[model samples]
Target: MNAATQYAISWKGLKNGTYHFDFKVDKALFQEFESTEIEDGDLNVSVTAERTEKELSLHVAIRGTVTVACDRCLEPYQQPVAFDGDLLIRFSDEEQEYDGEVLWLAPGETEASLAQYIYESIVLALPYQRVHPDGGCDPDMLSRFRIVSEEEFEAIEQEAEARHAQPLDNESLSRLTALRQRLEEEDGESEEKN
Candidate 1:
């Protein structure tokens, strides 16, 4: 089934009542969205849809793991995700904007797709710091990106200037220069804040 129909619910014929639905989420979802942050996933979505005279309410719950890049080391790792939320679908004669809490639907529409909601919920559930557990990053990659103390940064700067050294590759040197500029900007900002 197309992703549009895979997770859709046909509520046009349903009487005012409660219904349950299950949908499996996989790498196909991320592929459909062309997601850069989430590479792959194995997840289950359970939805309890309640139909009323005026509106439909869906309680969605998702659980599983997704493969994403580690923010620190840029290596792929599985991150567990769990999300629970309620979505309200209100029908109107005019098409309206969908706020995060409520979904506006045209009265003529027969089905509502949960694909976008499921994708967004999983993404939102991810941590701000998408990194592996302590000591989980690849040691080699960590070694490539080092954060130095202010004094150590100055010492490295002095040695490079004094020796006219080009010991590092272009990529390494670029990374070092960027890091140095960021450190200087941070220090300047802090001094201004004081």
Candidate 2:
């Protein structure tokens, strides 16, 4: 089946009532679309379409796991996804943009493809930062990246604390004061020369 036909719903022939549909979305679907972010997943999508006198209401529910490369360690891991959203399809004499949740369908349009909406719903549900939880990432890969051990971190922190704790000695203070005086004298000589 064509990409559009694969997810098309023929609502024109159906009477005004409620209908249900179940779709198994897998790697082939993503490959057909040449999707880069998500190439492998086993998800079940349940759609409920309610046809009314002038409009159609669709409720989409998606559940399952998708494999993605971790942003931190670059290792593949399965991430669970579960979300539901609603959409409204309104028939129009002429094409026009409808705001939020509502879709405008031109006159004589008989079928609507759920592919785009279904794809977006799943992608938007994914986290912006894809990563493993805590220490779930591969330790060997993580080590290749810039990360310090507990002992090294502790040593650095202690060095900072010690530097802050120490006060300047009297001899060092005197040296600084004399240096400041010499710098001022040099400034005076330069002013005179100018």
Candidate 3:
């Protein structure tokens, strides 16, 4: 089902009273909104609503984990999510924008949609530095991004100048030496046979 219809609460049939709703959040909701930060998640959205003659007050709580890319290693990791906020829905005939705290719905509308609110709340709740726990990053990826000291960079630059080309690493240098030795041995053997 579309996220718009799935997360909506119908209130036209009810008299003034309090109501509760439980919703499960999965990949579909994020996919519907084309969320780039949140790749996937398993979350619960609990909403409690108090309806009166004028407006509906909603208390929203969300808790679970979402998959996101780690800033350090660039690998996907699970990040915990928790958000608690309140929203008020008021009936109006004129068009009004949702200001994160209040929602304006026409009196003729039967359902109050919570899809955009829920998605926005999750995005805002994410941490600025999204990453996995210490020592949990991929070693290989971390090594690729290792910081080079000034001395190491200077040595590399000098070596490059001496070689008049890009400096070769230890492994590459050893392989080149072994290949040269093998070629010399083959040349010696052929000369002896001749």
Candidate 4:
């Protein structure tokens, strides 16, 4: 078969037994997959394939470091990932079905490639929200965030104060005070009513 097929397992040669394989995935391998999340990094993958008369089972363990952009500052940084999972490759007459951690393949199929499994393990290992620790971020980036936060806080406080200091004539003030008294009386009444 072609390179991609070769990287994937061929079901024809598989025997009804367990097999162990180790692979080192580098930048070139990621390029082959066109994976943007992991542009450059060396990943260690240990896979175990067990075949029975009825179906096949695969277990994959992956550990590596990948360079990814920081969500906060948009700067590139290294992130370590570790993953361990199992896959059940059952024979099906219909099309493949992949649910969460399980896979269904054609019963007639012989070999299954580990490439897709490795890629998925790496993807799953990534954090949902990636950010550097509080003080671990870049100085300039942290300062910028701090300044923006302070400015926003000041603006909000000013808006609240301005709202509180609205100009009111004596008549309006008296009406407002009367309204306030009415509200207080209503609250007191409710408290007693309750």
- Quick one: best TM-score, which candidate? 3
**How are the candidates ranked when ordered by TM-score, highest leading?**
3, 1, 2, 4
- Write candidate 4's Cα lDDT for 20-91 as tens digits: 877777676667778877767777888788988876687888888887776656567777889999887777
Candidate with the larger lDDT of 1 and 3: 1
Residues 1-194 of candidate 3 have per-residue lDDT tens digits of: 89999999998877899999999899999999999889999999999999999999999999998999987678999999999999999999999989999999987999998999999999998987776776777778866866232344456556645886656777756755565565566456546644
Model 2, position 74: C-alpha lDDT score: 80
Model 4 TM: 0.63
Q: Which stretches of candidate 3 lie over 4 Å from their true place?
A: 147-194
Per-residue alpha-carbon lDDT of candidate 1 for residues 1-194, written as tens digits (9 for 90 to 100): 77779989888998999999999999999999999999999999999999999999999999999999987678999999999999998899987887778888899999988888999899999987777876678878866865334566777667666657556557756866986887887567556644
lDDT of each: 0.85, 0.77, 0.84, 0.68
As a TM-score, model 3 comes out at 0.75
Ten residues in a row with the worst lDDT in model 3?
147-156
Backbone clash pairs in model 1 (N, Cα, C under 3 Å; residues 3+ apart or in different chains), count: 0
- The ten-residue window of minimal lDDT in model 1 covers 142-151
Per-residue lDDT for 160 in model 1?
65
Model 2 lDDT-worst window of ten: 146-155
